[model samples]
Structure formats: C-alpha cells, structure tokens
Target: MSDIIAHTGSAFRLTLRRAGRSLLARIGCDCPLCGARVAGARLCAGCESDIAGSMADPAVPRCPRCALRLRHGHCAACLAGAPPFSRCVAAFDYEPPADILVHMLKSGLRLSMAPVLAGMMARACARQGLVLPAGAVLVPVPAGRASLRRRGMNPAAEIARALAGELDIPLARAVLARRRETPRQATLDRRARRRAAQGLYVCREPLAGRHAVLVDDVMTTGSTVRAAAQALIAGGAQDVTVLVAA
Candidate 1:
C-alpha cells in the first residue's frame, strides 16, 4: 500500500510538471542568460549560439577520459591514472554566458532553466557521437543537505530529470545517496577536493550490467562526479559516463 501511494504521488508530480512546462511554452518568456525576449524558449537564439560555440573545440587537444582541455598532450592526472568514468561530455566550457545559466539555476533558483540546459547537453552528446548502450540509466549526483535547504531543489537532479525526458531514458533518482556533507569543492585545492569527495557517495540500487549516465550541473575539478562514478561502479554498474551542463 505504501509503494502504491508513492508511485501515485510520483505520477501526479510528473503530470503537474509537464503541465507547467506546457503553460510556460505557450506564454513564452525572456531568456534567462540575457535580457532578450524569447518566444516559447528559455534561452534566446543568440545566447544559444554563443553557448554552442563555447563547446570544446574538436580540434583542441583534450583528455580522452575527463575531457579536460589540454595544451598539447592529454591531462597529466588522466595520463597517470584514468578517472573511474569512461568519458565526460560537457555542453559548454564553464565561462561567461554559459556560467550564467548554472548560476541562475543554482543560486537564482530558476528551475525553468533545467530543460534548456538539458536540451543543450543532449545536443552535445550528439556532437560527440555518444551512444549509450542498452539499459542505460541517468543518475544525478545528489546535493548536500545544506544546498537542498537553501535552494529547495538539487540542480543536478533537475537537469537529469529534463535530460531523461529529452533522451527518453529511465532516471534512477534515488540510486545514489550522499553519505555526508563536506566543505564545498570550490573552496578547496584540487588534491583537497579529491580527498573531501572520497567515499562521499553511496549507491543504494543494484546496477549490474547497466550503463549509468551520471548528470550534473557543472564539474570543475571533477572530484564530485569522480566520486559518484566510483560509487556507481561499486554498485555493479557496467560503466559510467558523465554528462554535465558545464
């Protein structure tokens, strides 16, 4: 009986969310990044183009594992030892107008920007020719308690929800859980960030033989996603791929 109630509640919430999105599409709104008026979209065409142009240049050298930009050779960290994830795909570099989208979603609490970011992420996957194997599932990195209390929503989970809809994939919303809250990664050095993220996440679901597409809003040092991927692998996922809004 409890399971039936939970499933019904989830269905009700999903229906309400879809209705809200449809209403927004009909009314139209201004672009969140810029002040430009947009019709039936959250981002203006100019802003979208700027974001598309900000994607990592295919010609530039980068780490095959983490997608970190490189001057000539692959990233030293990835070279010394590859990250747990198979590959990382970012919609755009974390800069300028693109950064604004993340800020709006996270700090500004503009939940409507999620689908816009997800659409771009889906396009980024296409640009990279990324193909998910059968039984691939989207799993969002869970937010810390402090962030959830402040923002009232996890930006990564919101993006993952929209991404799942865009890609027509299943979303394992509660598969990964945060073990404990630590200092913000932005406040720590690279090595410290990795240490802080160690064993920070745990997988609650069995993912044996399934491909996991990890989703996040932005990845700086990649410590968070790396930790999450390790947890997924430990949970028996075949492999993990990272997709971020940047």
Candidate 2:
C-alpha cells in the first residue's frame, strides 16, 4: 500500500510538473540547446550555444573514409586496410551534447528531435563535400527484438526514417537483420566488441550494386557500423556510407 501510494504520488507530481511546463512552454519556455520553449524549459541562448560549441568540426584529423582518428585527415589503417564503405559522414563528436541527444532519442523517445539532428548531419555532409549517391538508399541498422522491446523502438531506424523522409530517399527495411542478441558494445573493449559483432548480421535481400547510406544515432568505437557494413557488402551493395546524426 505504501509503495503504491508513493508511486501514485510520484505520478501525480510528474503530471503536475508536465502540465505546468506545457503551459509555460506555450509562452516560449524551450530548452536553450534545442530552442524549444516549454513550461519549465531552461531555454537560454547562452546555454545552447555553449552546448553546440562543444561539437568538433569535421575538419579534425579523422579518417576520410570512416571518420575515425587519422594522423593527418587520413589514417594509415584506412589506407593500408580500407573498409568496404566508400565514405562516412557524421554531425558531431560523440560526446556531451551529442551523447545527450542520443540519450534522449533512445531513452526519452524524443522523435521530434530527429529533424534537428538530421539537418545538422546534412550540413556536416555538405561542409565536408561528402559525396552522396544520386539515388541513394537509407538503410538503418536493425535492432534485435529484445532491444526493441526494452527501448520501445529502434533508435537507428527512427533516426533513419526521419532522415530518409527529409532527404527524399527510399528506406530499405528488408535488407539487413540482426541475427543475434549481442551484449551492448559500449561496455566492451575493442577486441570484445569486434568478436561479439562477428557474424552477427546477415543480408536477406538482393542489394547488388546498390549505393546505400547507413544511418545511426551515434557511433562510438565503429564496431557495430562496420559489422552492418560487412553484411551490406555481402548483399552486393557497391558502397556503404555511414551517417551518425548527433
């Protein structure tokens, strides 16, 4: 009885807060970083600018092919052992504000933020002079049933859906599928992550010679994206370009 009452009370308090915020938001109370005013929005231009400033520019010494660290804008690893993907594009460094955005997308279910993030990614691609296929297909990394159940939706797919709509490209959902339920890659080291991701993705459809852009909310160690790229390559994709929108 006590626990139930506590839960109910908590719910009531949260509802009141939300209602108050909604009312305030109508008057322009949005978060500073996102420029969305809500009832209790800590929306301040200064705050948002501070957060936005944390993102690294695409000019940093990163591998041109996969956006990984490069000694001088191009990594020897990529040169010596190039990835199957022809190119890669990302919006911001996967830190602080970027991580926050990804967290909101996954845990807070902030679908509305998709457009904002996607737009930033588009801008990044443009700035880097990234080559996009004329009729490219957006392929989201598939999530496992168990993960979907826990998160309520696939973060990558959600971002890709919004991105595809904005880019006017067709999203191919039937191409790749997650063949196993692997542990979260974030907790594992590079070797473990690679081992876990090995042989975990399978292409079930014909993608022979198709140019594809793989979409995801974040890219940490680049293992998951690589695994997906391998699968897409096996499926006959001529090229795979990864996009991390945040």
Candidate 3:
C-alpha cells in the first residue's frame, strides 16, 4: 500500500513538472539559443534570427582545419600544429545569448529545446555546404559521471540525436565514453584542463574509415573536444569534426 502511494505521488509530481514547463514555454517561450524569454515562439524569433545571421555571416573567419574563428583563414597555432579533429565550427560566439542557452540546456533539463537548436544547426550546415556522406556519425562529447548525474541526462547526446535526425545521419553514442570523472573544464586553466582530461575518454567502438562529427554544448579552450578527437583518431576514424552548439 505504501509503495503504491509513493509511486502515485511521484507520478503526480512528474506530471506537474511537465505542466509547469509547458506553461513557461508558452508564457515566455524560451529561446533555445539564448534562453531568452520572448513572446510567441519556442525560440523568440529575433534571437533565432540573430544567431542564424551570425552563422551565415562571412565576416567570421574560421580555421579550415579546425573550423575555429581565426584572424585569417588559419591561426598560426593551428597552421603550425593542427589538432586531431579535421574540422570544428561553432554556430555563434561563446558570449551572451548562446552562453545562456548552453547553460540552460545543460543545467535546466531543457531537452524540449533540442529540436529547435538542431534546426538552427541544420540550416547552418546547409549554408556552409557541410557534406555528411551517408554513414557519417554524430558523436556527442562524452560527459563525466558528475555532469551526467547532475543533469540526469547527457545534454550533448540529446543535441546530437536531434542533429542526426535533422541531417539524416547516424547518432553513435557508443563510440565514446568518459572514462575519468575529472575536474570541470570551466574551472581549470587551459593547460590544467588539458591535463585533467588527458586520456580521460575511451573509444568503445570501431571508428575506422568512418567520418565522425563530435557534438558538444559549447567549446571554450577546445581541449575537451581535442582530447576526445585524439581518442577518436586512435579508434581508427579517418577524420573527426566538431559541431559545437552555437
């Protein structure tokens, strides 16, 4: 009798939570990209347009090899020694709007916004003519135990699944796993971050000859993605690309 009552109570709370999200989504219509509260849309149309415009703009210089915004076609560091990833691209600046969106999506359990963000990414890919040949895989950045536990779900994987659906590619979560629950990247310095994440990820599946695209909620110093890319390369992938949530 007690178990039944507890289960019912938990179910009620879950339903209420969903209802609250629906109400908030309708009242404020959370912007999927900026987490802004606006009227009449899952993503306030203006914020969507702004982020889309940033992606479409030609003014943003990116490294051809890593896809990071460079002063020119390439950054000297990349030119001298490129990372493991074949390409890397971000949809927007790491600053406001995009930052808020990434934070909310990861910490607020806003899985509802994944599709909207995926659509934005699909459009960006189309505009850039990123060719994901069939069999190309979308592998979201693996999260440490702590991050996954805190969110109750892997936000990066959720975004990757939505992106894969939009792009008609395969989502491959099994290829990579976070082996070490290390210090948070946001808290560590660039060097410390790299050291902390060193060999922290393991490739669990065959990636040989496969075109793999790594997905993540955000990119800061690029060490985490780079480390994961190294693991992917070691896994036998032909090349690795990074698709950072704008």
Candidate 4:
C-alpha cells in the first residue's frame, strides 16, 4: 500500500509538471527562432526587426515571373518568353541571416522554422497583392527519394503544408513525384542547372482545370521550379504560381 501511494504521488507530480510547461508554452515567453526570452510574443523583438530590415532593401528590383532580383521590373530573359508559371513571389532575398535561416531549416533539421517562413511568405504575397484562384491547391516541389532518405524530411513539403494551413487550401503532395534524381542545383551553373532539371518531375494526377501554387525553399536560376510547373501544366493544370521562402 505504501509503494502504491508513492507511485501515485510521483505520477501526480509529473502530470502537474507537464501542465505547467504547457501553460508556459501557451504564454510564449521564449522566442521560437532565437530562444531568447520575450514578452508575449513567439519571436523576440530583435529577430522580428532583423527580418523586417532584410526585406526593406529596394535596390533589388523584383522580377514578376521568378521573383528574383533583376535590373528591370521583369528580367529581360523572362520577358523574352515567360515560363509556365504565371507569377512568382519570394519572401526574402537569399542573403546573410535569411540564407542562414534557410540552411538551418534545410540541413540542420530545424523543423520549427517552417511555419515562421510560411508566415513570411504569406506576408510577401499580401504585400505584392497576390491572390489565388478559388480552390487552388498547394503542390510542393518533390524532393528526390535519395535526398528524402538522407534528410529524413522534405523542406519544401514542410513549408507547403504549413502554407496550406495558413491559406486554408488543400495540399496535394501525391499529385507530383520526383521521377529522376538530379544533382543539386546549387552546385551547377545556369546551363548545367537547366540540363540537370530536365525530366526530373512527373505528375500522376489529372490537373485539368485545377489551379496550383508550387512551393519551394529557394529559387536561384528558377530552372527546377520551371520544370515542376511545366509538369503540372502538362498534366492539365489551368495555371501555376511559384512561391518560395527565399
């Protein structure tokens, strides 16, 4: 009887401890990104300010098709001929701390950054006055099977899932698949990157009359996304848009 009483008391203490932690999390006194103590916020003030500053640079004019930095409103290349995607929206430039955050999320296995990045992307969309067609689906650029096996998760898919929840849209991961493995785009030049992305993705479901927004972690030359968008259009999507974290 004494042993039983002691066990019950320990269990009660553990339960109380768990409840306390839950309450603290709800209060959110610690920053999720930097782990600093904050006041009634998920991210600390410093981190918020840094993110805002990163997006305030005006020298990097935006390109409408790929959302990349360009000399003109839309790059001369994209203006010469548009890709399959209608528009592109990138939340931050791939520089400094923003690039570090993306690397951490991709290689460091920092899964918590997904929702934060998705929120930034949503804000970017709002700032650019981007609105999806009704019933549009969020399709993530599929990671290669080998990459998925090594990384244990797809960063693009993680971001897409979070963005879908934020926008109240359906996620369609099953519709697209990476049919062939390719070298990392970061390692290749523009010509090599284009060749590497060729025939990399395939669509399995009928996308006829369906609208889709492709989600990715970053866009460099935009070749990989263009390939994915082409696959979606070939599968019968009405149109596609590209959304990226940086």
Candidate with best TM-score:
1
lDDT of 1 by residue, 146-223 (tens): 888989999999999989877768899999999998986678999999899999999999999799999999988888
Off by over 4 Å in 3: 1-45, 71-77
Screening candidate 4 with a backbone cut-off below 3 angstroms (N, C-alpha, C), the clashing residue pairs are none
TM-score of each: 0.86, 0.75, 0.78, 0.81
Question: Tens-digit lDDT track for model 2 on 1-246?
Answer: 999999999789767865754564356445626665544323354544454443344445666677765666557546656676777887766676556776776778877566556656765677677767676889998887877888788888877876664565678876789888888766799789878888788888878788888888877667778889999999988889998865
| lDDT measured at residue 49 in model 3 versus the true structure, 0 to 100 | 70
Deviation in Å, model 2, residue 155 alpha carbon: 0.5
lDDT values of the candidates? 0.87, 0.72, 0.75, 0.80
Q: Which stretches of model 4 miss by more than 4 angstroms?
A: 1-46, 52-58, 72-76
Per-candidate Cα RMSD to the true structure, in Å, reads: 4.0, 12.0, 8.7, 9.5
Model 3 is weakest, by summed lDDT over 10 consecutive residues, at: 21-30
Clashing pairs in 3: 66-88
TM-score of 4: 0.81
Residue 195 CA error for candidate 2 (Å)?
0.7
Best by lDDT: 1
- The window of 10 residues in a row where model 1 has the poorest summed lDDT is 53-62
Q: Write the per-residue lDDT of candidate 3 for residues 1-246, one digit (tens) a residue.
A: 999999999789767865654565456555555657775334666776776576556787666666666775568647666789877666667777666766767777777767566656676677777887667899998888887778888888888987876676778987898886897777889789878878888899988799899988778777788889989999988888788776
Instruction: Report the lDDT of model 2 for residue 22.
Output: 52
